[model samples]
Target: MDRSFYSRSSLIINTIESTISGDRVFTGNQPDDFALAGLLRNTKTACLLGVGYGGAVRAMLAGDPSIELTLVDNDAALIEFTGNLFARSFPGVAFTSETADAGSHLREHPGCYDVICVDLYSAVGYPRMVLDVGFWHDVREALTENGRVVVNAWGLPEQLSPLAPPSPQHAVAQAMLAVWQDLSHLPCRRNTTFVAPALTPADLRPPVDDASTRLSYEDHLTLGLIRLRGASAPVLLRGGIGDAGQPAPTSRRAIDAEMHARWPGLVEAVTGRAEASADFRAALSERKLTDAATERLLLEGSPAASFAPCIASAKAQLGELSMAWYGEWLCDEWFRLKALDPDWFRMSALWQAVCMARTPLGAVWPWEARLYDMLSAELLDAGFADAGV
Candidate 1:
């Protein structure tokens, strides 16, 4: 139950380990932020709904000073804390603190935002609004001329959307197909959609400046990487929306196995393994995580050799992961420290207050948020977000 115990630098290593060991890494499912960020021109303004701990808000503010930001979160305390923190980090950009639902806010300001994030972690996977058909409709109205929306999720690629593209995540893969067909029929000026993981070279057509305009080759590659993971949207557990179903640890093992099968070649390529571990720990050992030469191999073979440094960047994540892991452990150690020495415990918590790691593959706190933020933003920084996107 100690989150930190399991979240050490090793945890960060796990994300990159898959790729380092040469098994499957990136999942070809890019993180939300990286993918999302690329959608904006450098000077674009943006809004981050559900600011939670403000990771995405912080990253957005730091990465693009020109971007105007309005952060919304239901937690007043969290909103205030993150707002103030980011205010100091980004003094010039527009920063608004609104205590409201994501859907409701968008409804009030239609066609105004360049980016909208339907992130779940701030809600801890409970964005009830997404479950409603009417909600997505309002979201459609919320976009600016060339706007994009990213629904950050914790589900695996296959489970990202209910059945999968040409599908939805409501039920099984079949259910996804049904939903996609229905969604395709919905009123819109040619709304395009696809699951991130399953998008193939052929699936994404280049975006036409006008619907009839031919898409550039670069645009097609970008669009192709943003598909929802797997074949459909991730399946919601039996009860509420956003709650990942605990299908028993055994069930999860089975699911992870299925995930392994989807793209053996890519996973192996990233991890350099014949077969990835069901345990993942075995695959992500520091031996692999710290391989400085790892990126060299990837760089030697690809035209994207410019991305080689990312493997090196992934190494930076280890330190952040270590800090976050320490933070999590520190949180649980309050009582222990109290017994030994109150002063020591206070210092422990203070140390955790600062996590300074730029790379997602190494960051201690789950880089999932950054992954989504950068993915949503669409920056191909050679991290898992790059592969996943």
Candidate 2:
């Protein structure tokens, strides 16, 4: 697709200011989950497929004015609304809306972009159409030979469980991993990373574990900020929602009834337990061990692979990012949201600077607690996060 194909209409204006420091952001994670800010640091052409509020697009504008951007979303209002807002600031960039699914657009616009980001969210479980089948082929075709596709897979409802903090990134990474693995079937390529809370340094990096080969994952973990590992993973998730959604949370009774009917089976599938409930804090503690050990063991699957760094700058904040993960929602999401809703999305990401000092992924945020409640309250909302979960 040409510039005309990249520019469309209708958008929104709803900004969420940080509850703490008045910062704005997208949703959960920070600007760059793996410091992709650096990856996009010099990128000249960029596209956002599922532009929910379109914050990443704005980030690119601020980072490099020379960059060109295209944002595509199915929502006509959002498409039109954001188009106008950004049009004023980014005269040269493009914004468009389509009555089509992201995959269809990619198919039509072959080898056209430097970066293609899929920010799909819904209840059908990660827009299955985009994951396998023809979608990957179209996406590959739509991108420049050296282009990158960044997908933000929303985690599953059970994955959200107010019962505990969500494992959003794991699901995100896995979604891309499946695609990478499938594509690599051609035999000339290999998916670079499976960055996970499950993986340990030994699971990915060279085992020498000494100078010239000290594992960065461990350093980040010890410092508290885990860097992206493996090759630039195709996906990065925010949580793990199951194929099926959970019951509505309009009331504790409805939640309980639904839990009784479908939640237990789902929980059993993920945790392998029979109807036992989990706390978010407890889950985080246990998951850290389970995920790390799990990653270490996964190495056998790819003998030729070695661990890649999870963060572009693992030393940033001196490892505090890892520590504050559980306590504060990644402030980065705020900036992302800010890009869309400047009013509501305040820049409170720096709160991590302080919160990280108090807890290491142990404490939870009060507002996020309310957000989960709201997110769970709407049975209809699950559709918003279906893709990439």
Computed on alpha carbons, the lDDT of every model, listed in order, comes to 0.36, 0.35
lDDT of 1 by residue, 76-192 (tens): 887886556435443333467788877778889988876665543321233445545566667657777655555543333321112232212332222223222222110000111
Give lDDT for model 2.
Answer: 0.35
TM-scores across all candidates? 0.42, 0.42
**Candidate 1 deviant stretches above 4 angstroms:** 1-35, 61-64, 89-94, 122-124, 157-389
lDDT of candidate 2 over 313-336, digit per residue (tens): 122223323323432332324334
Backbone clashes per model, in order? 82, 88
